[model samples]
Target: MPQYSIKDHLYESQLFINRSIAAAIIVTLMLLLLGVRMVYLQVVSHEHYTTLSKDNRVKLQPLPPTRGLIYDRNGVILAQNLPAYSLEITPEKVESLEQTIEQLALILPISEEDRRRFKKLRRQRRPLRQYPDPSTPER
Candidate 1:
C-alpha cells in the first residue's frame, strides 16, 4: 500500500467533503422542487383535477320496480307476480363465451332458437322483464 504525505491526506479529505456537500445541496433542491409541485397540484389545480376524476366515473344504472296487482271484489289475483329465472353474464368476465355456451348447452336444455334469441337480445341494453300468465282467470 502507498502511504500519503500530510498535504495529500488533507487534499483527499477536502475533496471528500466537497463532493458530500454538493450531493446534499442537490438532494435539498430536488426535495424543494417536489414539494412545490405537490402543492401546485393539490391546491392550485385541485378543482379541475377533481372534475376530470368525476367524468371518468360517469355511470347509468336502470331501476325497474314491480307493478302492483289488480284484484276483483272476490279475493283473486287479477294480476299476479310470475316467477322468473334469469342467467346473467358480464362481457368483461366472459371470454370466448360461445365455447362456454356450447359447453353449457351440452349440460342444459338450450335449443338453437333459444340460443339465437339470446344472442339477438344480449346486444340490446334493455333490462330483463317477465310478465304474469295472461290466461290466469279472475275469481
Candidate 2:
C-alpha cells in the first residue's frame, strides 16, 4: 500500500494572492517614477534647453580686413588699392542694350572707350557683365 500527504489548499491560495499584490505595487511605483522625471525635464529645465537651442541656431561670420599697399625694394609701387566706380548690366533685364546705353550716357558721362569695351564684353559673355568707368582719374 502507498501513503500520500494532504495538500494545504488555503495556505497556497493566500501565498498566490500576496505575490500578485507585490507585483502590482512594483509596477505602479515604476510608472510614477517615470511620470515625475518627464515633468521635471519639460518644466524645470525649459529655459536652459531653450538657450542652448538658440545658440545652436544662430551663427557668426567674420569679415575680412582691407588689404594694405605693397611696394618694391626700389620704393616703386608694386600694388596699391584704388577706389573705382563700375556699371553692371544684365542682358536679360534690358529690352535694348543700345537704347539703355544711350539713355545712361545722357544721365552720366560714358566715354567712347567705355562704350567700345561694353560692346566687346557683351559679345564674349552672357548674364551679368561688369565694367569699370574709366571717367574717374587714377589715384
Best by lDDT: 2
Pick the TM-score winner. 2
Positional deviation of residue 95's Cα in model 2 after best superposition, in angstroms? 35
Candidate 2 colliding pairs: none
**Could you tell me the lDDT of residue 19 within candidate 2?**
99
In order, candidate lDDTs are 0.67, 0.74
Please give me the total number of clashing residue pairs in predicted model 1: 0
lDDT tens string, model 1, 1-139?
A: 9997566888899999999999999999999999999999999999999999998866445445488778989978898766554444544455776876777667667776677666665565444432211122212
> Which portions of model 2 show Cα errors greater than 4 Å?
1-3, 61-139
| TM-scores for all predictions | 0.39, 0.42
lDDT of 2 by residue, 1-139 (tens): 8999999999999999999999999999999999998888889999988999999966565544488789899988898876644455676667997788788888888788777766666677756654433233323
RMSD of each: 15.0, 12.8
Off by over 4 Å in 1: 1-7, 59-139
